[model samples]
Target: MARSYSSYIVAQSKRTPCLQNVCQFISDDCRKHDCKIVSLEFFAQDEKPRRTDLDQLNLEALLNTDVCGCQGRLIIVEDLSTAVIETLGSCLDIDPLFFASQIHGPTFDIVSSKPSDAILPSRALSQNFLSVQYQRTVDFGACSSAPRKMLRNSNVPRKIVLLPPIKNRSIGLEQQSCSILLSTTKSKPWLGLILVDKPNSDKYTTSEKQLVLPSTPFQGGYEDFSERPCFFEPDSGSPGRVSLLEDLVYYWEKERPPAFQPDQPTLLSLTYYPLKIAAAEWVSYVAVISHSIKQFEYSTEATFEEHGLRKIDSDLRSLEVWGRRCLQTSSKLQSAISFLKYQINGAPELEEYSLMIRDFEYIADLVTTYGRRLEIMVPVVTSVLQITDTRRSLKEAANVTRLTYLALLFVPLSFVASLFSMNGGVSAHDLTIYFAVALPLCAMVFFVTRLPTFDFVPLGPAFGKFGNWMRKAL
Candidate 1:
């Protein structure tokens, strides 16, 4: 049976006509094959954290429920479908364009349609509910080292499956889009909704073999080379592909900060922790990319000759790709900072997050620095390649010069010897004449070739006068 997303439309006559149109569009756009919900977690300062099964609970009522004192509730939706998006949009009264951006991945011109009174971050739409959408860089270890045809199979499970526009490309860096929407009121703190675009990881199994293997057969590893030069193994500490929902759940369960007290009146402190975590994760990505760039640069410098020009050229292109991705990530972080600044300045309810503003600024600055470093390193790498080419050219020219000298010395002697060996009257009568002619002729050739080695100080003025005379005559 074919699954039809468009058939499951929920009617909401209470919304504006514009919203209705947006909802209809979302319903139509929902893919028949959609991502399932990963997990549902609710966090409270005093009570133990708990997970709710999707089949047993009512998402609509749960999202709309008023919790004046609870810390926060986080809903993790993976590989978005029309039903989940439609339901969340209706429940939170979120802008339709946000879901639109989710359906159609964020673009360069992702700007809010609203005026400055409600300007949101990149691809975000400001309203009574505040949301920010940003791209998170994924570290695919050696799978992204060099361009190859590995991991192309769709049937194989992957830890992170990017949206249609972002999948299966050698863009130096791979990214997944994540949007965080916070619904708040004057009395209530906020209800957090995080929409992710990765596949659910229920069936994912990580092993020693899996660590060495890429997701698809043609994804990114040499099947033959054990120590593949192209493969870049991510650091064990690096957070390569993390689920924001799962990470939050883990933090709330095991690593919940002692600072979060039950006496706190608002959930503002708990809600934006995910954003902070997101920013911190980017900091890790910048480090990993920078480390990879440095490692490649070192290899090129160490053995430029052994690798040859083609290898160095490929490395240069890879460096440029890394630099570009870093710039993009930095730009996204800057937008997040701007959005937070606006929230802190304008929204009285968000004044508490002023400190988080500094943290984001610091992280953005760090990423920008690494990006600039990669940019600077590109020219240095080019220079090394140029030096290698120059060396090779000089060596080849020297070999040609040696061959020319050998030909000049042997040609005159061979000609004289052949003439003496002839039987006819035209042949040389004696070998002495042959020797006499060949020796002087060889010396003359040598002198002519070595003329540039002599410094003609005595004739310098004469040559200068002659060159001036020719110029005047012309």
Candidate 2:
């Protein structure tokens, strides 16, 4: 369900009607040129997941959605659409056909050896979107088809670009909104959005367009795609909310030390949104992994030896996934950092960009290194567990062997006593005979058991000499 966030921030009018009513209310003064912000949170697994989980990517469906302002009024479409897609080779290991099928569903029919997994007019869009394979040697082409029935689940598609036409009789005609982004965390490395409407020459075009209207969160049911499970989630609409306006509102009200310029908001929304998203990603990951490390180490300790091995197994796997995430994330952040290069505007913003890039770049590396080291401990911990099992087994076997030897010592005495008792009646003389018989057997058994040397090497030289002498005597 979409709710208006216009109240959260300072806006001219707070009339947040359903998104369906956009056409009837488009002409409203507050609706026109009013900044609309929509934030969609993304969630993805570390590996290629089953179709049921992701269904169709969120962005792809959004781009393909029939967005109309009125009942059937001509919605403006962007003249040009630009998208930057990033992916890791490890994530997209399937062939282009299979990948496309997974993303576009069974209806997704883009059969090619090269990775063009996107549903776009040009093959280059798919090719560019297949940047994951680009990281490694070119390989992931097509794989066997996995058929899925016509599924219209509640799953939200990847990137949703709503480019409705701006109708103004005063201006030339109607101008369209363009620049579409269709990607997922697995298919794309970095997770952020850039939505800006520039003044396109012609009629109905204006520079006051903000991408997402309705003040609503334009996200579907991504119950799974959540931030890394952290110690605690920052308050919503808080500075930690990862939105430019939220922070600006807090800054304007709370921290009003220096004269804050108006452009800072634009700089943040346009350029630094990605950085904020990326930074949040890093923070969430770091918090989760650090907690896991402690939990893992604690579980594997001697005190918790019952399921120690299993605990290590889980924690180590987590570490490995985290490392892969870091490796993939670093590249995506680099692209973002590079993109931030173009976003530099004034002196103050430039300095902010430099500091952010420097600090985040270090954090990106720090995450990678920390995760790799943690992952390496998997094998070591595994070996320790094996040794612990082997040692326990050996000790048990030794105890069993000692018990067997002790039992052997009493077997002969038990047998002799049973034989004597088998006689129905025994006189004193018979008892004396039984005792005598049993006594010699017990003495012989004891003597053998106590022998210092069971085997004595005969005089080998005497045997050889005797054989020679015997031959002559015979």
Candidate 3:
């Protein structure tokens, strides 16, 4: 056979007589419906009069109660006393679900009706008959006509009654339509209410606040509810202002990992905003340096032939200036890194900036290394070009001088030969003697022709091999 189940509603009141009357009413209703009354418990502090101490009560009254062989229903009624509300407001840690039922109980199935002329009796009687319970009188003149009925009909307790609206202001209404309402009372420390406004379908629209009571406790620190200090606000002197060095010290003290020691090189990262600015500056400096070096290379290539030595000397000076400037910029970058490191010591997000600075430092070192090589190569190449130019000029001069001397010696010889040939030879022996003399002169001419024209070797073949190798390698 299927077993019958009973529902248990847990409630609390300001006094025991009120609690007993409510329990008796619920029990009578359950008996009329052929359902059994499982159990009912009241939660209240011991210091108050007519209060039941749930902590000292018998556990079996609540634990052994059966409801359809399932977990018995738990209905909690909380009296929102003034003390309870004040205690809840001051506490940061409290469960929000325990007070949800009482705040939302009256609105479970309220029906709309016109304002009535009849007055409700302010008194009631209970089975125990020890005390007469009087309903708390509420002044509806302070409330709007629409919500006044809902408030008057709700008989939960005097302490939990919703207060009437303050004059000149709409009570329980939020400025923003989408905003939620939060409620706190001393009796239930952890509960909060989320009130929403739902659109009405009726032509006669009335402003109604729908309360959303959370069924669970809110889990977070009290600081979560505290407001952060505004940027423009003056400091409250809680702690002194943070300086760059102080910031670094604080991070080094607080956030530095246990494995990290003061002796080890600390890596500081940069925030995106500062890092981007620094990167832009570094890139601009690099571009300027590159342009200056390119100008030097251009000057070197242009005046190499005409102003060979002088142009190279000028280029050397310019390169040195560029190197000095690069060094200066590098120093500035180092200083920036140091400053930013101090600022970003404890900041985890800005760590990348430190890496970027390190990379820029490496680039600066590379530039310095290359600058040294350029210094050496500039003078060497200039000397080689000068020596090559001098050798070419001397070779041309030697060729011209050799041709002039040869012409001077041959011109007279040619004239004498011509004079001797023009005259009739007196005898064969005389002609033979003249021929022998001419033969010796011709032999000397041949010997002079065999002599090298210039002392320096021709540059064409030697330089051609070098040029060809360079082309292939490049």
For each candidate in the order shown, give its overall lDDT on alpha carbons: 0.51, 0.35, 0.33
The digit string of per-residue lDDT tens for model 2 on 207-242 reads 343221111211110112123445586533334232
Model 3: runs farther than 4 Å from truth? 1-275, 287-314, 342-349, 352-356, 404-443, 446-474
Q: In candidate 3, how many Å is residue 359 off?
A: 4.9
Give the Cα-based TM-score of candidate 3 against the true structure. 0.29
Over 1-474, each residue of candidate 3 has an lDDT whose tens digit, in order, gives 532111111223322222332333334432111111112221232111121223213322433343332211211112232223223323322222222222322222233211110111121111100111111111223334443222211112111122223332212211101111122223322221211111111112123653221111001100111135589987332211111122222222223322222222122211222233334334433433444455444323433255655655666665565555445455544544454455456666545555655755665575566567556656765665576567668878999988966675675467557867777765787667677777677655544444443442466555555544443442
Q: In model 1, what lDDT does residue 405 have? A: 87
- Model 3, residue 116: what's the lDDT? 11
Question: In model 1, where is the ten-residue run with the lowest total lDDT?
Answer: 217-226
Q: Distance from true position, residue 94, model 3, in Å?
A: 52
Ranking by TM-score: 1, 2, 3
- TM values, all candidates: 0.63, 0.42, 0.29
Writing each residue's lDDT as its tens digit, candidate 1 over 1-474 gives 742323223332233222333344454563544444533344454465556645213666666675655555556666666566657755665555445444432222233222221333443424333334443333333334333311211121122322111133322223345555555533243455566555222222233212232332112211110123334765223222345555555555544432344333233344465566666556556555655665455444434365677767877877787677667677667766766675555665454466677777887787778778778888888887888888888888999999988877897798787876684554344666777899998886665555443344677866555545543442
Q: Give the local distance difference test score of model 3.
A: 0.33
